[model samples]
Target: MREMNYFIVGDVHGCYYTLKKLLQNWDSDRQKLIFVGDYINKGKHSRKVVELVRELQYRYPGTVCIKGNHEYEMVRYIEDGTKNSDIKENFRNTLMDYDLRNKYRDDVKWMKRLPLYYDDGDIYVTHAGVNWLGLRKFKENSSWCVLRYRGRLKRMSRLQVFGHTPTESKRPEFNKKSNAINIDSGAGNFDNMSAVLIDDAGKIRKIYTEQIRKEDYH
Candidate 1:
């Protein structure tokens, strides 16, 4: 059997066209697609972005979509009916998109079930990198670490790839000492969406990006 490569995507906050262009680099037959999440909000096409991601997941059996902090906030808002201003503000765009499209219940249910991380032995993918305490402690009590962790991460046995805090350089940042990478290029904000290709051994092979299209973000 041939070794499967992985295309780990960064935070995609409703940059539908940008993500579409980025996936042009993906080889579905040889590469597993993994999205770090935040598929909605902060952009104009949240509905289209979620629909496209859902379609991709259905078409690709190897696709993995991890939960993100934005997803957590939206889920909490929907389920708990929170009056928290921050959550409301963060979720407003997504809510408006869903309302306009008349699709929310099913997608919210799907988001509610999203996993916090993906660990395939050699590579670990999550929305956010773990803290200095390491993955074991994170797995034991992962209230917010998996989806919201920031700053320096703990060195781990396997390479950890995550996307949550957008890199200041507008590019993916790799930390050799910790064996980790941050791929968030602020697709929902000022930068482009980015993804990294890695071999079965967890070696980064390439970086792919798509500049945010005005139609998708504006």
Candidate 2:
């Protein structure tokens, strides 16, 4: 069995350029890249975003991926909603093309089928944080995701890495738990963007693209 040296990335949010830039900076032909999801939304190139992810996943077999809230919501809007979602401007603006919009719906349904977590015998990876309120009742296919997802997986014996709640605030007012780490860094907030890699020991290694592009967000 191979000891996992995973390189986990935060929410890409259609920042394909930045994501490509970050991957280049990482400069590793060896390390496995694990993505925590929210690969679309809040930025341009959502259609391009999923394609890249799929390409990489194909290139690297067994690369772990979990679906995020944005992905979950988009699928809901497509499969169950009576009309198009009227939430906000975010990344969907860039997906106005008919083909890309249809692609997003297909991608979302695909994302819905993804596993909620990945455990390589050392680190556990998830999209949103595990649920805390009803941890006992939580499962990978749980219907409620945004609110109580993290608390759901708190019982995992190993370190859990997740992205959803942005870690943009430097004050550290967010989760201080040693077991779970958040790396979203507001990339999908249409604000500051960041992603980090965690070692097998659950230590944070590097954070890329600390500064958000003014044009990408607003």
Candidate 3:
């Protein structure tokens, strides 16, 4: 119970309603919230999701977020303009509601400011693994395994927690290493959401769910 003291959530994937539900009683002054990225896309409420994040930033002031590949693609679209493969249309459409079409490009700039890595004395967090090697022989820096997984897991300094690679299930598995936890069980289209919390000792505790009938689940 005496641990990381923060309740960190994983890629919300535009499920603002779910996030709101999960965040009930969250007190910023007591327990901090760390969002592991991918707060938008693939769900129907990207604007709502982003707005919640914006408001939280204002209210909480020192909250933390990491850069997910989705946000990276968003930066690319803003910087060099979109190509056919920036991301999916539905996702872009969701963000379009936020009017990220240049005049509001600052939102993307804000997103891009998120760092590729973080170490919290007791944990490391990222959207993907840290490919010390960048995008050469290994997968691109955008891949979850590198930008979200490695940067946090490879070291013994702290527990690593992340999102980005959607887990197929909603249960806790052994972290990639004894010290890292992956919590991105897809919240985009599923009835379940997932997360990981670390204790002061850097031990991981999983917060997850099982599929229930949609009627009973929501």
Candidate 4:
């Protein structure tokens, strides 16, 4: 296997320009880029962001992409044309980010294939934090467990890294007691996009980002 350093990026939303700026100096050969989902909605250029992520995975063999709630909604919309107004509104917003909203079936299929979580011994990457309240009852394949759980895990074996609930400071939140880290810096909410870099020993090296503002895009 190739020696690789993992860099997990939080929700990108549709901030394509900001994400592009953050990846300007990334090295695909020696590093693995893992995205903690929510790549669409709330900003512009959702299509480009998805395209870029797909391109990166193609170029880098070890790249990993986790599924987010937004993706789940997309899959539901495609499969059943769900009647939930909230889901419909969110999916519509996501589609509007792309010029070709009518042709998003392929993206829905791609999201459906994405794994909910990834485990690499030292660290665990998921879209949202695991349900600590019900470890014994937790189902690995449960969409609610992977996409909606929020609280910290009670007895996590490895360092849990995730991005779903945005931090108040618009930065990655780390709790040593729970051994959990939240990296969703609210990029979907028109804030900054953050990347958490970790080494083989499970040490977080740095957290960096490129800011996004609604005014600038407007």
Q: Pick the candidate with the highest lDDT.
A: 1
Model 4 lDDT, full chain set:
0.78
- As a whole number from 0 to 100, the lDDT of residue 139 in candidate 4 is 54
How much is the lDDT of residue 59 in candidate 2?
A: 82
Higher-scoring candidate on TM-score, 1 or 2: 1
Residues 130-194, candidate 1, lDDT per residue (tens digit)? 87765453452354477877777878899999988888888898999999999999896848899
Residue pairs with backbone overlap in model 4: none
Model 3 per-residue lDDT tens digits across residues 77-97? 667766646657855676566
- Expressed as tens digits, the lDDT of each residue in 95-178 for candidate 4 is 655533357567777888988888889888888877777553235346447776766565577788999899999999898888
Q: Candidate 2 lDDT, tens digit per residue, 91-200?
A: 34644642434645666557778666777677777777666553532353464453225333354567767777665472112244546677677766555555566665
RMSD of each: 2.5, 3.6, 4.4, 2.8
Compute each candidate's TM-score over C-alphas: 0.91, 0.78, 0.78, 0.88
**lDDT (Cα) of model 1:** 0.82
TM-score of candidate 4 versus the correct structure, residues matched by position: 0.88
Judge candidate 1 at residue 209 and give its lDDT: 75
Residue 49, model 3: Cα distance from true site in angstroms: 1.2
Clashes of 4: 0
Backbone clash count, each prediction separately: 0, 12, 15, 0
Best by TM-score: 1
